[model samples]
Target: MSRSVAGPEIERLIQLMARLPGLGPRSARRAALHLIKKRETLLGPLSDAMRVAAERVVVCRSCGNVDTSDPCTICTDAKRDPSLIVVVEDVSDLWALERSGAVPGRYHVLGGVLSPLDGVRPEHLNIEGLVSRASEPGVGEIILALNATVDGQTTAHYVTERLSHLPLKITRLAHGVPVGGELDYLDEGTLSAAIRSRTAF
Candidate 1:
């Protein structure tokens, strides 16, 4: 059988930290020790922030974003292009796009992609909301910003089909060679995509 070196409170902290993505038992242990050592500077603030987030964070009803508001700042922003909607697989993707400042309009988070093997179906995602939003008169385009993985492509195709009936243009994030990337380091898919998506100089 295993043993407990610390009290239940400290051990519980380690267990909880281990649940975070990219954190395993050893990493969690190190993190827990760091937090404990810096309790006054890091742990207290983090705990308070978590408490506030738990209390106030809400899933936006219109776009499925997590924020302190229902519609979220993005959905309510008057400056955002109402004619375009960038569809992403998750809030993380939405944040990434926001950081890049490449998206020209509001966003619709699908919550997750369609992974039949993982039992994630259309009903499991926010596809119904997307279709409903796409039906609106002002929405003229939908840009699928999903990853290039098989599951991501599958989900994008499914979403395209769902929104096809609407009188709106649909686009996807272009796949190609990345800037400053060596040709030899890239895989076949990237090289092929770069050739297929070649643009004018």
Candidate 2:
């Protein structure tokens, strides 16, 4: 089998799309072709949306979640409990927790876990922000909703160690999180079970 050169512009689009998570060269090419076929409906709008999002999206000042504004809607929501904050590794995990509707507390997105192999370190994440949040006046507990991977557990332990001085009760999600599984992939039932059965660290 042979593939034709998709011209420079299409090739550029394919390259950019291929860089996205879960998108390979073949998938990127297919998506690019689809976009080209429906340029008015899909490609043009997608290009404009991506440009706008790139310009406006910024990290939430409080929780590090990606938002169009500095203090994201979740961080500014007055109805959320200040006494309980769920710590997650990334925005996707935070969104997963929200979808489950298990915790009503605020969230602190760590940006990512500590993965030494990938050159991710404690300082690279929002560990200091988490520790500071734990020591804040109203915080009583911190639910570590990180993934169940080795790196996730290691990051959790590191966070726990950093906040040992704070009075807040530290807890980890229960074993409903499958070994090497991310929070985003778990079902609502499984996520609920994990939260309910969360043990003290």
Candidate 3:
């Protein structure tokens, strides 16, 4: 009998792994078999790692980033430009920008964009935190690096309206970003070019 068919425990494991991003039921079964075959090499270590991460991982208090520390490494970094802050819809977008090595300023992740159709609103995002950051002394610029989607544009316009009274310079990523595309899918060169050519929105 197959390991998964042998017990409820193994079956449950396969079911859960199947739910992961790219893994389907067949792949999950194959992965479970592979992990069982190399139990010491993969399964044991993976279980331990997941447990540790689940216990230790927490949101960065200041920026809402997933990290072991409170403020996150970026927020605590003294070398990063505190005068400027690039706002991203997700941490994945932040990672994409970092991979390009084009942005010198610090980042603030919005977690997600405003999509009323999907039940997401301004209150669902980190707009209040962003406004507070903008009001901070020595902060000069706020760059919106949201995806070039309808909801993204709506969120950007909303943020701009909220911060209009602030003296900080507000800017958005350039139009080079393809419509309906995500920053996480863009190449480093493309992301760098878009950021360099950024204009007010």
Candidate 4:
């Protein structure tokens, strides 16, 4: 039988680290060793940061973004266009879009896509909150920036239907081949979207 190399406490830390996204057992072990070697500079600060985040982080009531405030920094930003709202799948997607700096409007995080096979339904998402926000005065448009998947499309349709009676104009992200991407390597759906959404050259 193989004997355990690290003490129980260290082994527990490695196990917990392995559970983090993009980390596996081997990588976690390496990370744990590195942290131990740099306990003062890395591990100590990381532990403190994690504790603070765990204690202070909250879901924004207005846009569903995760932050230290109920309304979140994005929702509270007066410079952003309150008339427009971009609906996304998750907090991660919200971060990605924010990094792009392409959107000057506020955002609404759905928390997840509609995946019936995965037991995720409309009720499981933040659809009602989105409807409520869209109904507010001064809101003019809602842009669905969901993924190019069947579930994403289904959720978009459902949201559009739910807000159909409202005065807001509902739109979706344009689908097409990405920049610097080759047509030969593009998927059929992307190629078709590119053809259909072709612009004046």
lDDT of each: 0.94, 0.89, 0.88, 0.94
lDDT of 2 by residue, 121-184 (tens): 9889998888887888989999999987899999999999999888879998766787799999
Stronger candidate by lDDT (3 vs 4): 4
Per-residue CA lDDT of model 1 for 124-180, tens digit only, reads: 999999999999989999999998999999999999999888899999988888889
Per-prediction CA RMSD (Å) = 1.1, 5.8, 5.9, 1.5
Arrange candidates, best TM-score first.
Answer: 1, 4, 2, 3
Per-candidate TM vs. native?
Answer: 0.97, 0.84, 0.83, 0.95
TM-score-wise, the better of 1 and 4 is 1
Report the C-alpha displacement of residue 159, candidate 4, in angstroms: 0.9
Better of 3 and 4 by TM-score: 4
Regions of model 3 farther than 4 Å from truth: 1-6, 177-201
Report the lDDT of model 2 for residue 160: 91
What digit string (tens of lDDT, one per residue) describes model 3 on residues 2-46?
A: 444647877988889999999998898889889899999999999
lDDT (Cα, 0-100) at 70 in candidate 4: 88
Error of 4 at 183 (Å): 1.8
lDDT by residue for model 4 (1-201), tens:
125689998988998998999989889999999999999999999999999999999999989999999889999999999999999999999999999999999999999999999999899999999999999999999999998889999999999999999998899989898889999999898899899999999
Indicate which candidate wins on TM-score. 1
Clashes of each: 0, 0, 0, 0
